[model samples]
Target: MHWRQKVDYWLETLGDEDPLKIDLLKNLSNEKLMEDSFYKDLAFGTGGIRSVMGPGSNRLNVYTVRKSALGLAQYILDQDDDAKTRGVVIAYDSRHLSQEFALEAAKTIGRQGVQVYLFDELRPTPLLSFAVRHLNAYAGIIITASHNPPAYNGIKMYGQDGAQLPPAAVDSMVGYLEQIESELLIEAADEKQLKKSGLLRYIGEKVDLAYIQALRTIQLDKKAQPKDLYIVFTALHGTATKPVKKAFSALGFNDVIFVKEQSFPDGNFSTVKSPNPEDAAAFDMAIQYGKESNSDILLATDPDADRLGVAVKNDLNEYVLLTGNQMGAILIQYMLEQKKLAGNLPEDGCIIKTIVTTELASAIATNYGIKTIDTLTGFKFIAEKINEFKQFNSHTFLFGYEESYGFLIGDFVRDKDAIQAAVFISEAAAYYKNQGKSLYKILTGLFEKFGYYKEETRSIMLEGKNGAEQIERIMTSFRDEPPGTINSIPVIKIEDYFKRESLDTVTGEKAEINLPKSDVLKYKLEDGSSICIRPSGTEPKCKFYFAVKGKTAESANERLSELVKAVFNSTCDLALHSI
Candidate 1:
């Protein structure tokens, strides 16, 4: 069908119920709106689905949410009988129409006679991960866009193990989702009817208490209480301020300040460019508050509170923001060194990180005599490793993190938990302060010990459908013919994860990489430098990650700078190699 025909079909089917659809139908004579709405279904990547809020096939609304839920219900029902009874747990973050979307999914799944446990109000994404296991639900759904702007929203699906659904499961779910022609004509039972039938339950408080208590158990140094290590925190206008503050107070951190302007659940995220902790702008309010309080540290969480961003006072007493890689490296070093000192370090424990994250974490893990496992991007892969360890009883999960400010210290919640991270960070700060050392000093000490491993990331966003195709082309170009050298450093090895193949440039030998297929490429340099290229799972962008090492921080910075320049210089020339 032509795009216009699809637009008319959408108008005829949904115009009556959705005001946005009605307004859009009225403007159908305009070509741009029709093209925008009917160009295609919103792209569902490995991160489930996210899109602008509108009344079209390409947007997220009541219709799209129901259709997706119905498809998930079909997939789950086909999986097993236990899956049918176990149903799904649903949670939402503080976003426009988030609550409505969560309930819509419940109703759609309920139409299939599947049970649901819905949170009474907004909660963090990690809570939903915990609820899935606590209730033994077959799957879970979290209605949040993470740190996206107000005009956008999303739906993330979790598997039975309380992690984001794996690739195979997502592929199967997408196969069924494609067959959904319209929203399910769901017949929902009232709360009373659902309760009487024992298929629907509302949960709160109990789960919150359990989650908080679990976070408390991972403290590295419980006795190192510092009296005056004043700290400032901000939630970036999302769902974490209250819980994070409570976690700090519970940990006995006496001087904590909240960024009042960005503390509440403001959908606009009015104070910053975006709510992503990866961006320095997200910490503006917290930084200001830190300066006022003479705080030793500053912390900020993204919308759903899964990712944490931190800042600390430097030698000149100026607040210096740390990248996710920097934070993860510091945390790992602190945890391992302290655990060994306390005589509690596990003999058979392991740390986990994504392939594209900084190498400093792996180096730190190696120094602690703990093995590090590298998974593909996304916390689901990290959670999958955690689950694998639990099933076999092979190794204990010490920590899991990504370069995007997502970190998990304990296994209480399968996904990243800033609430947990905040607690550990506070404890670590207190530990160092007790010894008359600042976190800043401790970080420099690690750089000295770890050989100054520095890394950086750059994302190039390509918007809309054409951008998507271009990204595919870009990846294909690199896979077929990778550069022989980067910045005059000979390429020693290349790993093409999509084909599960690794090649030795020097020997012309190839070997199978024992991992699931993913569209990512990594190149190792002769100088112990590396570069990784992968498409962003949640956004319309492709990412390039650069890692370099040197004897000193200044040399590491220069080496990293040369590597980044080489990658950018080859971008256009490399794309031309695609067929």
Candidate 2:
């Protein structure tokens, strides 16, 4: 349909409540806006749908939400009455209209006579994942945009095992979603009817207690002197505040301080420009508190509370924010070492990390004689592996992490749990503090032993209509004509995940890749370095991740600077080619 027709359809479907819709409608009459919204429907990719909060057919709003839910409803109902009875669990983060979206999904599923277990209040994505298994529900839904800015929101679908829906299932769901030709015709149950029928139930504290209890078992160094360690924490004005702080207190931490301004669950996220813990500025308030309190460490979780970010006081007594790679490495080392000492390390235990994550973790895992599996960039893949091993498990799940601030310690929650991560990091801090070593020192020791590994990620964000096209163009170029060398290191191999093969750049040899097919390209260099190119599955951006190996900390810092310059220059060159 033409953009104007889609806009007119929206205006007829949603009247005055959508000012942004109307503005987009006015712009749709122009050639520009038409090309944008009419280009394509917001993609229901690997995890589900995520987009800016707006009224276009390609954005996230009531219409999009209903369409997504309708797909899920169709998929579940098609499985027969058993699936309906099994139903779905629904939870939301603290975002604008998140609760409303969750309710809409519940009603849509309820209309199909499916049971719906909805959380009574805002909850993290991991809890929603846990509830799916806890209730033996057929599926789950999490209303969150994760670390995205306030203007964005999303819907993530999960399978019965509490992992994000796999590719085949998502494809089936999208097929069902597309069957509903127009948004105006989508159907939902009456909220009162669903409630009165007893098919829809609201849950909260019981599930929270169960989740927290499971987290306590994952604590490796539980005997650390908690009273001697001073810790600072911040939720960055999102959903993790109460639960995370509560987890810390339950772990016997006596001197943890919270950054007051960012401790509450506020949808606006007033204190920071973006609630993402990946950015250094997001911890400004927490760092200030850390300084004042003379805390040993500072911790923060993103809006949905699935990803944890940490900063520690260095030898200079200045707080240095630890990279996702750094934190993951520490957790892997500590968890494995402790498990080995306790003689509880499973003989067949394994660790998992994404293809784009730092190789230092693989080195650490290898040192402990533990196998490490590499998956695509989402935690869902990691969770999928955990689920694959649960029954008659040959390899017990040890730990899993990605370079994007997401980590999971145990199989308690299938997805990342920052509340649990915070508990483990506090325990690790206390244990190391008693030994008179800082996290920074431990990191240095790891680098010394396993070769210094440094990584940097650059995201080129293109907003609105043209931005997405630009991102697509860049990805296509990389797939078609990859670089031969980067920073004077030969591009020895190019792994095309979409094609499920690794190509030898020089000899032209091809080998199959065992992971699921994805639209990602990774180039392995001769010096044990690598780079990955992928368009953001949830956002209008393309991300380039670069990793380099060095002999020492200073050398690693120098190489990282050089690698950044080279990568940015290459990106500029690639952009010019796209233009």
Candidate 3:
């Protein structure tokens, strides 16, 4: 059917009760708006569906959520009978309609006769992951868009292992989702009936207790004097306040101060432009609180609380935001230092990081005799590695992180856990304070010893259907005619993850890449710098990542600026045309 026909079908079939549908119908003359809204179905990728909330096939609305939930229900039913009994765990973050979406998913699954353990209120993404393991559920669903803006929301699926569903399972779920036609027609079980039938159970404190208990085991130097190390924490109007405070207080960090204005769960995220911790602007309130309290460190977590951001007082006595790479480096160093001091640093222990993350991780791990394993760009791949190593007992998983502010300290929760990270980061700060140092100083020391390493990421937003095709075209152009040099730095090697091959530009030799296939291209420069380009799996943007190593920080910064300018300039024409 044509896009216009789909739009008309939605307009004619939608119930009169939905204001969104009414508004959409009132704008029927806007052909561009209609086409953009009905051009294609919102994609259900490996991370599940994410989109702006509205009344369209491409939007995240009640109908779309119900359709996806029904698809998940069908997938669950296809499994063994025992799987249905095992059921699913549902959690939601502090996003608009997050609670509504969670309930919708539960009811939809219940309609299929599958039991569901739903959180009574909003919870972090990590808690959802933990609930899946604690309850031994067959699967989990989290209603969150992570750090996206107020206009957007999403639903992510998790496997029994408490990690995001792998590619194969996601593909199967997508197959089932495609079979769903007319989201308006998808039937959901009545909520009251689902509850009375014992298929829908509301859970809260019990699961929270279990998850908190599990987090305590990862705290190192819990006895350290946290009183001497004042800390400021902000949830950015998301869901991190409760678990973070509980964990910190449990570890005797009573000097912690919460940014009261941003502590509560607010879907609007009224405090910042974007709730993402990676953005320095998100920490403005926290930094103010930090300075007023004379705090040692300020930490912020994204809405879902799976990613953490840190700001520490630098030499000028002002709070300076640390990049995700810097924080990951500090955490790695701290975890390894404590483990080695306690004589628990296993010879086979390994650190897992995404290929796009800083090479400083590998450099630091080398000094401790700990192996560093590189995975694809998502945390699921790291979780997959943790499962793999556990099954084989070949190596112990020490820690895992990605460049996008996601970190995992232990294997207890099979996802990037900011709750666990908050506790450990606090403990690390206390340990350094007792030694007469700060996290900033420690970070600088690491840079000095490991050689200055800098990494930067740029994302070009391309919205709607035409944008996706342009993104594909850009990738194709780069793959076909790989850049010879980035800022006069020769491209010595090209790693095409999609082709599962590494080509030596110098020798024209090809080698196999053992990781799963992905639409990512990485170029290795002669000067030990690297550049990677790929479209975001969850957003309508093409991202470029650059990493450069230099003899000093200034040189690295200069080189980074040059490379960024050159890469963007090279693609300027294509980007402008696409826009």
Candidate 4:
């Protein structure tokens, strides 16, 4: 149908139920907004449906939510007969209309004779992953946008193993979604009737307690002194406060101070420009608190509590922010040293990282005779690796992390658990303090020992239909005509994940990459630097990653800046200052 037809149909069909939607349709002056809203259905990528929340078919609303649930229900029914009996677990974060959407999905599933397990209140994404395993549910749904602005919301689906549904399964669900013609025509089971029939259940503190218990088992040093560790923590106005505080206090870290202004759940994320922990601006309030309390370290988690960010006191007594790569390196080194000291380092132990992550991980793992496996950018690929190792019995999963501040220390939960990361980071800080060292000093020492490695990521935000096309154009241009050199350094090789081929630029030989096909490109330079480009799967942005190694920190930073500038300038006419 034409875009105008879609707009007219939606306006006529949805006028009575949603007044806000009617207001949007009546405002004919905003032709661009109307066209954007009805141009196409919201794209359900590998992760799930994420978009601005609104009334059109291309936005996240009750209709789209119900359509997704109906498709999921159909997919589950197509499985064995017991699949519906196992049912699905539903959780939501503190986004606008999150709980309402969760209920809508539950009713839609329940209408199809499938059971529903919904959370009583908002919870983190990782908790939903844990609940799937704890309840042995057939699938899971988490209603969250994971640090996006207040205008955005999303839904993420997981499989029985408590991990995001793999590529094949997501494709199947999308196929089911395609069979439905109109979102407005979908039906949902009556919420009251579903409850009366015992198909709808509410889960609460019991599961939270179970998750905390699982976290306790992953603590490396239960006997370590935590009293002297004055830590400052901030939840960034998300859903991480209660569980994080409980876990830290239970572990005997009594002096942990909470950033009061940003402690509670506020969907607007009023305190910061963006809720992303990777951005230094998000840590502004936390840093102020840290200085006032004379804290040893500062920690912050994103909206869903799946990603963690850290800052440590430097020699000048000022808090210095550590990039995700730096934090991952420190955690790997700490875990290995402690495990080896306890005489528990496994001979077949291994760590997993994404291709874009810092090579410093390999350097640290190599020192302890551990193997390192690389996967695609998403954490789901890392989770797939963990599951693969379990079946093959070749490698024991010790740790897995990405450069985006997501980490998993144990297999208790298949996704990144910032609650666990917060605890482990605090404990690691305490251990270093006892030995007369700060985390910053430890990180510097690691860089000195392992040839100073520096990494930086720049994201160019492009929103709406035109922006998406521009992003595709940028990616296709690079893929077809690869760069010969970057910042005066020769390009030694090019890895095209979408084609699953690696070309040796010097010799003109092609080799296969033993990973799933993805829309990512990487350039390997002669000086051991790497430049990778890929569109963000969850957000409307294209990211450029740069990794460079040098003999000194100053040299590495200089090289990194030059490479970043070259790439940005050569690409589309993007703002140079954005980098």
lDDT digits (tens) for residues 1-579 of candidate 3: 688988878878887877877879788898877887888888875467889998788889988998888888899999999889999999999999999999988988899899999999999999999999999999999999999999999999999999999888888988998898678898889999998999999999999998888888998776677888898999999999998988887778899999999998999999799999999999999988887899989999999999999899899998998898999999999999999999999999999999999999999999999999999998899999999998999999999999988999978799998988888888898899899999999999999999999999999898888889889988888788787877777899999999999999999999999999999999999999998999999999999999999899999999999888888776532232444
RMSD for each of the candidates? 2.1, 1.9, 1.4, 1.9
TM-score: model 2 vs. ground truth: 0.96
Error of 3 at 83 (Å): 0.8
Cα deviation at 546, candidate 4, in Å, is 0.7
Q: List the residue pairs that clash in candidate 4.
A: none
Candidate 2 error regions (>4 Å): 15-35, 570-576
lDDT of 4 by residue, 253-289 (tens): 8999999999999889998999999989999999989
lDDT of each: 0.85, 0.85, 0.90, 0.90
TM-score-superior candidate, 1 or 3: 3
What alpha-carbon RMSD in Å does predicted model 2 have with respect to the real structure? 1.9
* lDDT for predicted candidate 3 compared with the true structure: 0.90
Task: Tell me the tens digit of each residue's lDDT in model 2 across 1-579.
Answer: 766677667777776767766676567657765566555688876457877777677878877888888888889989978898999999999999999999998988888788899999999888988889888999999999888888888999999999898888988987897788986577888888889999899999999888888778987777666798898888887788778866877778879898888888887898899898898999898888887888889999998999999998777888898999999999999998899999988888899999999999999999999999999988889988887887656689999999989999868788888987898988888888888888888998899899999999998888767887788888887777777877877899999999999999789999999989999998888887788889888877788898989998788778778777787766533442563
Arranged by lDDT with the best first, the candidates are 3, 4, 2, 1
- The model with the greatest TM-score is 3
Alpha-carbon TM-score of each model against the true structure: 0.95, 0.96, 0.98, 0.97
Q: How accurate is candidate 1 locally (lDDT)?
A: 0.85
